[model samples]
Target: MREVDLDVFASELAEGAFAIDVREPDEYRAGHVPGVRTAPLSELGAHLPALPADRPVYVICASGNRSAWAAERLEAVGVRAVSVAGGTSGWARTGRPIVDGTDARSA
Candidate 1:
């Protein structure tokens, strides 16, 4: 799994990069990148087919661990994916915007 700095991740997002958040529903509900898809690690296999294969998907979580694991799994199956180096915390700390709404993931 490749690691990505928040700047690169933000730039990629601005340029319309695809992203997947591999955190559990509860964690995702707390907060996540604005354009990221919620594909929790537990359900990645079923959700993988829904993701675009041609684009680089940014995998993220509260920390970097779960996303990295998801990245590895995606790469193993030939999906182009990378992990956000410090995950959501990094993005939040870097002043990147976040979607402050209800926890949609849990529902």
Candidate 2:
């Protein structure tokens, strides 16, 4: 699976790239990158049909591991996806804005 560092991910995010948080709901509720939708890795298959076919999906998790796996899954099914290296933890550590709660749209 393709991977991108936080800086590239952040730049693309600013351009409105699609992103999915692959961490579980509780973890996602605790904190996440602003505007990222929840699609926990466990239920990812169910979300496939709804994913955009024309754009690259940026996948993230608490750390980089799960997102990497999620990205591979997405790629196997013809979706272009990239895992965010260092994931949300790195994003938060770098002081990027984080949103708390289940509301993915609350930015």
lDDT of 2 by residue, 11-72 (tens): 99999999999998889889999889989888899888878999899999988999999899
Model 1: lDDT to the true structure: 0.81
Residue pairs with colliding backbones in model 2 are: none
Give a tens-digit lDDT track for model 1, residues 1-107.
Answer: 78898889889989998888888877777788887878888888888778787778788888788888888989999988898888898889888877843634421
Ten-residue stretch with the least lDDT total in model 2: 98-107
lDDT of each: 0.81, 0.90
Clash count for each candidate, listed in order shown = 0, 0
TM-score of 2: 0.95
